[model samples]
Target: MVNAQQYIESSFPKHIYRIFAIGKNLEGHLDLSEYPNLVEVRLGNNPLLTSLSLGPSPRPYLTAIGFRGSGITNFSFLANLPNIHMLVLVNHTQEHQAKIVRDINQVHQCKDQEIEKIKQQIIQLQQQIQSLKTCENSNRNQNSPPNLSSERNNDTS
Candidate 1:
């Protein structure tokens, strides 16, 4: 049998600091634990992407992760990740919850201000890190590299 994991470990660039493959048609699980110098990863909006695992190698340097619309619901791998600073997990899996919150907000006008404050708190809680880059649904070029600061999703699969 072909050891896909070993093949990926040997083939992927060891010194890579980032992996931005946003809006690609990628599916299934992705484990990126070989590279020790990784600092960021942005894999948003594949919609089909189920699982993602990172660290135990790049745990110290890995700081940012953006998986806005990948459909990944489990983040247990990041429970004790100390160096991590930024995490953007919105859309799809969170859509139902957000919808419920919005509906409740509309119905409970008396608690509008309190609900607004709670929403801010929720946003702050989700964004544990500094630089956040997610969901550029307007223009996503899946043919090139990403320039997140400029709001471009040019990441290829």
Candidate 2:
């Protein structure tokens, strides 16, 4: 039996390569284990979707994944997607809900803030270096003796 992945590539449309199921009343488990070539899977704003299975291993070609405002709690499945570049997860787990969203976005945002702080520090250091260089040149000029040619002319006069 040909798998879903094979069928998708061999089908009439030919290039159909994504799954988008958003803002629906979908509940329970949504499995996409067969389609290995899935490029993007956007399942956002579906508050009833509790469980999801995106296969055992990481999809090689999978690039984008969006799952926000859904009932899905555990995002351990996200580790199985290494190639995912774009991800949108917002309000998937509410404060009162029993659903627990692990440390994914929180860690990411913190890292971003840290990077910005480092960049600012780098800029400040560069400015200080420039200021030091200018001061060194000014001090050297002030401390230097008079030119040899001027002294010789004065002696001749």
Candidate 3:
């Protein structure tokens, strides 16, 4: 526990890529600083950690985060982690679980709208490509031997 605080205050060692703080023991320590280089952090089963104090600068690089059985009741800090790809924050009660689901759904809705716009753009491009192919085929038919030869014969007459 003391080493964790020391590492947070001082520059983290180059070898430490991930940190997993579990159990109900790592709470009430007010010196949680930012590990900007830390890739992953797993803090579960910590009943004492009523509120999570996330340090800045570590938000962008964090790829995975898990917080199951923690005492966190609000979903404010999670809204800031943009680089987090995979997260699991399941609680024991239904009300808390519903709040997490609602928050995820709200975020997902915005992403879904963006996805729909991209899909529409892709569809438009495909339609334009198909139209171009049709125009090329029609031009080829007009320049074929049958059409060109008939026109040449008529011109010679």
Model 3 error, position 140 (Å)? 40
Give a tens-digit lDDT track for model 3, residues 1-157.
Answer: 3233543445445446676776635454323344556567676777655566566433667677776876666665565466678777766588777887788677667768989999999999999999999999999989876767779899999
TM-score of each: 0.50, 0.50, 0.53
**In candidate 2, where is summed lDDT lowest over 10 consecutive residues?**
1-10
Most lDDT-accurate candidate: 2
- Candidate 1, overall lDDT? 0.65
Off by over 4 Å in 1: 1-12, 55-58, 92-157
- Residues 1-157, model 2: lDDT tens digits: 2233333334423244787667655666666776666788777776767767778987668888887877777666766665568877676445623322335555456657989999999999999999999999999999999799999999999
Model 3 clashing residue pairs (backbone): none
Regions more than 4 Å wrong, model 3: 1-16, 29-33, 55-58, 108-157
Q: Specify the poorest-scoring 10-residue window by lDDT in model 3.
A: 24-33
Q: After superposition, how far is residue 132 of candidate 2 from its true place, in Å?
A: 57
Q: Could you tell me which residue pairs clash in candidate 2?
A: none
Write candidate 1's Cα lDDT for 50-152 as tens digits. 7777754337677898888876766645633446678776775566556534543453553566789999998897885332334343234454576675664
Q: Per-candidate RMSD vs. true structure? A: 25.8, 8.4, 6.1
Q: Which of 2 and 3 is the better model by lDDT?
A: 2
